[model samples]
Target chain A: MNRQHIWAVLLRNLYLVRRSQYRAFSLFYWATVELFLWGFVTLWLQDISTPDVKITLVATVIGALVFWDLFFRVQQSLTLAFLEDVWSRNMLNVFASPLRPRELVAGYILLSLLFGFISFVFVLVLAFFLYALHIWSLGYYILPFVVNLLFFGWALGFVILGFTIRYGPSVEILAWSLPVLVQPLSAVFYPVSILPPLLQKAAFFIPTMHLFEGMRAVVLEGRFDVGHVVWASLLNVAYFALAIVFFYWMLSLARRRGLLSRLVMD
Target chain B: MQESRLPGSVGIPPILKVTDLAKSYKHLTVVDRISFQVEEGEVVGLLGPNGAGKTTTIHMLLSLVKPSGGSIQIFGQELAKDREGILARMNFAAGYAALPYNLSVYENLNIFSLLYGIPDRRAKIEQLLQEFQLTRFRKQRTGALSSGEQTRVGLAKAFLNDPKLLLLDEPTASLDPSIARDLRALVRNKMRAVQGAILWTSHNMQEIERVCDRIIILKQGRIVAQGTLEQLRRQFEQDDLEEIFVALMALPEPAMEQTERPR
Candidate 1:
């Protein structure tokens, strides 16, 4: 929990983003393209639908997309930060320092918060300027939804990190694809009701599913559902706890197997 | 040939102490029950063939690899319990373990200084840059630098916190001979200035002969021989370290067993 060490890990990754154009582009590129692609799709939906359906469509679809991106970006930030060290063969340098594993994680979490918030705001502004959509219009419930999505994102991030550490860089595809694997189960684009009954039962365990369901309730029904928030929070608590345990377990196993050094050295 | 004081000669604990340290993966023992010490103001070269466990030994010492048996105590504290605190007073550099390539030399050093929590980071970094003759390359990306320059930056980063114990693993492996010689001199000078302990690993017998105050040679995960350069040369009946190393490698396992000397 040394702040200086945590700041160092965070600052090192920040310097990487600040220096490399490709890294900077990758951070914001997909999020921006998603925003624009969905922005126009919502515009087209607005033109086709009646005025009554039009207002809800933009807020529902675009807002969901923005919030989903928040979760994805946060998770990606964590994995990518770690992968940066691995790719540079700098993991030995990092782990050999005074910085603890938890401190390195804290740094990645901070980077996620920074990147997530920036991209969130960036897309929000774009949505506002292009389509006159206001996410804050969803009201104070946005707070809980954002918080739940972020926690779930971090939970998924830890799992991804755990896998990467255990298996090495060969399985890096999981970083890009794991969140997507969770997407359908999360019910990000639609209601859990639309999912098969079996998946709906499975989705109940996913905190993001409840948060997305909760977001729809706020946007469409104008209903403030405390139960959704409570369920999401409880589920997030369990998932996040398990995720941290998994991450540390993998790290301990890696040390025992000499995988940490082998990952960089090989 | 420098004669070295034995560990604990003056009642001060060696900066690094390992007793029966061992690491095994499944059925393979990479580092056998090997024990050694590096006292303050000493440079001990860990020399072995490619798979003789030098890197694994270094990894275990760093706690990057957990030993299956035995203990590592640094600065009189157990490494497992005080890894962060112990590592704060230690640093490592390897040619294969590089600084972030995309970052500039100054940025890399600055970030490492922060990691080590060095006060007066700017002054320390500037001094290292000047000392390593890397001032002109400060703003250049580390990846763009020559192999020798990159090794210098790596060395500068290693010295960032003025670690009490420094572990160098083939740091100049890729550099040209002249650059390697210069780096060897630089490291020796720096260690002397700080009166720090070093556990160095290299295949270059010449480099080890030039830089190491003492040498510990590992063969197949066991310490085959250890003493000053003069002692090893005498024991192996060779004039130069290269010949000594060649003779050691050529011996059968049973013959190698005969050469084992207690530290």
Candidate 2:
């Protein structure tokens, strides 16, 4: 991969965000709103519960929201960065350059990492200041869970990218909706045990499901489960590989069908 | 009439060699076995009506649209295998394709220069801005610029790499006559200086006559005629290039198809 080409794509998107106040503000908008909304819910739940369970309620709920937002934001960062080129009718110029497909993908992934980490930290700080919820209390276990969530988010991001490339912007709703559609299956707000038996079985295939389950194990039982991390990592490996294949397949199909040109013209 | 340099006259291969290139979607054929060449220091105008496959041809050359049959060799490498390597030495500009609207003119050029891997990006950008008369507007957002100014910025970005092969698609369609003339002169000077090749597409016959060393006219995705102005004039018995273009465009489909095949 050409580092210069990758850096060029990343720099191009960064310049867009840097120049526009609305776009810059959007980076933190949803994360902050979700933190506040869920922070209040954590407080209300704590007030109603007995003192013993109150702390558990705060950490579990707030941590889930924070971690879930990481996944969502990373996915959005990638899809939005790509759509920026499409919306500007700049795809032709971009693809016409020496930037390889892999390099372009690398650029989007790096953009997602940059934006995702920034929003993750912003929301973490906001949760601390507003609700006194300490995510760091989850200990070193938080690191693996965070990495697993990022992998799953990237997997989902690539899937959405493939769909957008295949169907054009008409299906951009999938970018916003697909992650939400996977939310229930992921059991972001609840344990897999609370899900129906059928969904529980289906959720086993979702890396986020394994990740959140592991996060709850640490928060509630103080048990750092290595098995959850292993399962999530293995599943992430499969899903991420599949996503990359799907993405390249869709790109080749788009080129053969002249969909790339259509997307530019449209 | 301009003198046409035959390919390989200087013992150098053509910069672009497209052989029997074809693209079809399902049952519909868009580009039908078209073959052409553009030599170094030459400007070849690609003329055709709307949907006559000019844009598709350009897209195929860029590898944005995959060709169903045939090959494209650029800089002595096959485009299918070394797309990135080939594209590094090529650049394209179009009236319809735009830079990111939110970025300033300078930023847009800077980003493209980086994409092209230009070694002296800042210097090249500054020079291109002055060359395109866009120095004062460097800080202005590309979207806020007037259409004509935007076209100039696009041209400047196209030159960022000092590309060996430049593909221009109706580049001056939005420019005023004076600006268009200046752009033609600038392109000619650049070509002469660098020994580069350009495959240009323009509906404006006068501009083509002024800039193009040879003309390839397409009708319904087939090359109906191709030659220097004098040769084309003599073949069609028409003095004006525009008149030749109109007569070729006015031909019925049957006659145009017949022209594509040997009589």
Candidate 3:
């Protein structure tokens, strides 16, 4: 691959994300809604907790919400990409170019990350003002948060995008349903510890539990949850690897069955 | 000027060459052992019916779909090995594909221009906008453009990098007759000054006759006939290109055109 060419593809896609009204509004809404909800919770719930506990709890909620949005954003991007292309028959046009499937996947993932970052930062800033809480761990946790969120989203994105490519019209409902199942089990609103023993074991397998737990540790306790963060990151990487395999498998299967052409067929 | 001369000054080689190309899906063969050459400054039209595998052949050539077996040399290099190098000097335009609809026309062109890494993109984009009459709609979202206008934008984008190879699929598909004529004129004028070859696919026999220097008729992914417009006309003994197309498409082939539907 020409590095510059790939960069150009990456940059152009980022610009598209930046230019889209829906994308911009999504980030704004995500941030604003998060601040509104959690900020309201912080004010009303303040008398029940100490200052440090309040900041930590608020940070944890906002952070979880960011990842929650992150999950949905990836699914939306993947499904919508297929839907848009199908609408205009532009997918066929893209497949007609020399652009590799991997490059296209990478571009979509990168765009999703940018959107994720925008939402994360938006909520972070708004929550800071509304809750009057110091997000002290913002300096250290943001990068990891972004990285973990992208790996999870992109990994899931591959599976969703792959399914859409193969069984687009029929399996589209799964696109919406996926986040609902994954996010609730991610232990965003509550600790995994609170779950029943069997469910707690399952939650440990979920990458999101580690992510939320890690954020809580850093922002709430003023210390890194090295074990959980590292484990989550590694698990995420593994998930991403599996997602890639799934995507490639789907592509090959589609090609073999002549369904790959459906990718470009409107 | 004398010092500027270099040894073996052949300039750029032919932009595209295909040798013994063949592709099949499962037991069904789509493109069967076809071969062709495209030099700079040539417009070659690939014509066929719905299921003749015209699109499949183009897909193979562009490396969008991998060929079961064949060799494609683009810009004096094997396309399989040097995709980016070859693609850097190439562009494609078609109605079925477009810039992201959510993006404005300017942003869309900018994204493509950035992909091509064309120097001085602002100036290039301004010129293209003016040339394609898209300047007035630069900020308009692509989804909002009329079919004819969108076709113009697509055509404009194809020429953005001054590519050595331009592949067009129904370049004037939905445009009104007058606008189609204008696009043909634009393409004709642009080709005159550049060392570029255009591989165009279209169902419009009249447009093919008007714009293409050569024609290749594919029946079930195989080239049934290929030559200049006059040659095709004389071979079929038809008065017009459309009649020749009708006659060729009417015949039975390995893959029936009736079974394959057009989008």
Candidate 4:
């Protein structure tokens, strides 16, 4: 729990990203491109849509892309944090030092937050200056949605981390694919009503649905639904709690089995 | 921290104590109940064949793998309870395990220095860079360096914190004979300065003979023999350490079943 140790992990990772342009650029390349592609398409759609629905059409499309990117980033920041050491075969070295497992988690948590903020700013700027869709126009209500999305991402991050630490980099594909699996279920780019009935039923367990639904409520209906926000926030807490519990449980199992360093050799 | 052991058995405590350390994967036991100690200011060589459990032993000591049985203590503190405190004063460098390849020699060392909370960080890094003869390559990416040079950097990082106990697995494996000898000398210098011990594993019997204070030879998954070079030679009636090793390996399973725990 030493702050110095936590900062050490953070600083070391920052140094890793700083030394490699590919590493640094990859952080924003996909986020920026997604925004540009989607932003332009949404902006063009404003003309085809009826005048009454044009604003709603533009807001939801662009907002959905931005928010989805945020959720996607939660996975990247954490998996990268863990994988960076694995790629270098540096896990044995780091874990051998006095650095605690929790410190590693804390450090990556901070890294994810920084990355999330950076991507948020990058998408907002790209969305605004390149296309006229302003995220700020969604107003103060987006704040709660942002927070909820972050925890959902964190929850997913922890689950992937648990699997990775126990099984090795073999499960890395899960880190990327899990979020996309949630795409149709959470209805990222579409409303839950558009989902098949079975998926809509399953979407109840996904907190992202409420957050997205709540976002559309703010933009399309000009209605601030406390029920949706409260539901999303509560589900976020529960999912994240399960994630943390899974993390510690897997951590101890890894320790007991001596899978910690060997798991990351690849 | 036992007063009785401190006063009579040895003045300085054993840097590392692995008691009945064993690890198994359900049906196969990788490390069978092996026990050993490394005293302060000593270098103990851990030698075994390919599947002799050398890596597994190192992994268990670092808590990278959990043991099915036994305990590990460093600096008179159990690793289970004091992993962080024990590890802070310990470092590991292996010829096979690499530093961050993309990181410069200096940056890699800097990361370690901070993690260990080493005081006077800049000076310590500069000292290690110059000492390891890596000053010229301080800014070079670790991956870009020659294997010999990378080994030097790995050792340099391990020494950055002035650790009390260092685990070096085939640290001289990748280097040429001369560079390996120089690296061995560097390790000796650190051992003297820090009053530290090292658990070293290597295949080079000559190098082990020259660099180590004692040796533990493992076979299958257990320690078959251990002692200083001279003592081991006397025990086996062999003139050379490698000959002793050859003879020990040739031992029948039933004979080696009775492991000689060399103090």
Candidate 4 lDDT over residue span B1-263, tens digit each = 10011111267678899999998887888899999998888888899888899988998788777788998989999988878888888889886678889999998898888889998989999998899999999998999999999999999889878888899999988789998888888788876777888899999988888888788999988999998777888888998888998998999998886657646
Q: Candidate 4, residue A93: CA error in Å?
A: 0.8
lDDT of 2 at B116: 87
DockQ each: 0.87, 0.87, 0.28, 0.69
Across B1-263, the per-residue lDDT of candidate 2 in tens digits comes to 43233232267888999989999999999999989888888889999889989999999999999999999999888999999888989899999899988899999998889888999999999999998899999999999999999999998988888888999999999999998888878876876678889999999888888778889998777888888888788878999799988998998877876555221
What TM-score would chain A of each candidate receive against the reference chain A?
Answer: 0.96, 0.97, 0.84, 0.95
Cα distance off (Å), candidate 1, residue B255: 2.8
Interface RMSD of each candidate, angstroms, one decimal: 0.8, 0.7, 3.2, 1.5
Clashing pairs in 3: A92-A264
TM-score of each model, paired residue for residue: 0.96, 0.96, 0.82, 0.95
Model 2 sits at a Cα RMSD from the real structure of: 2.1
Local error of candidate 3 at residue A93 (angstroms):
5.2
User: Which of 2 and 3 is ahead in DockQ?
Assistant: 2
Mark the regions of model 4 whose C-alpha exceeds 4 Å error after superposition.
B1-10
Return the lDDT, model 2, position B157. Answer: 87
Question: Compared with the true structure, what per-residue lDDT tens digits does model 4 show for residues A132-248?
Answer: 677776688888988898889888999988888788878888878899888888877788998888888899889899888888888888888898889888888998999989988
Residue range B54-108, candidate 3, lDDT tens digits: 7777766666667878889988889889766677688888776666676678877
Candidate number with the higher TM-score (1 or 3): 1
In order, candidate lDDTs are 0.88, 0.88, 0.72, 0.84
Query: On a 0 to 100 scale, what is the lDDT of residue A55 in model 2?
Result: 73
Candidate 4 clashing pairs, residues 3+ apart or interchain: A258-B65, A258-B66
Please rank every candidate by TM-score, starting with the best: 1, 2, 4, 3
- Arrange candidates by DockQ, descending: 2, 1, 4, 3
Docking class of 4: medium
Off by over 4 Å in 3: A1-20, A38-63, A66-110, A137-146, A168-176, A196-198, A214-226, A245-261, B1-14, B252-263
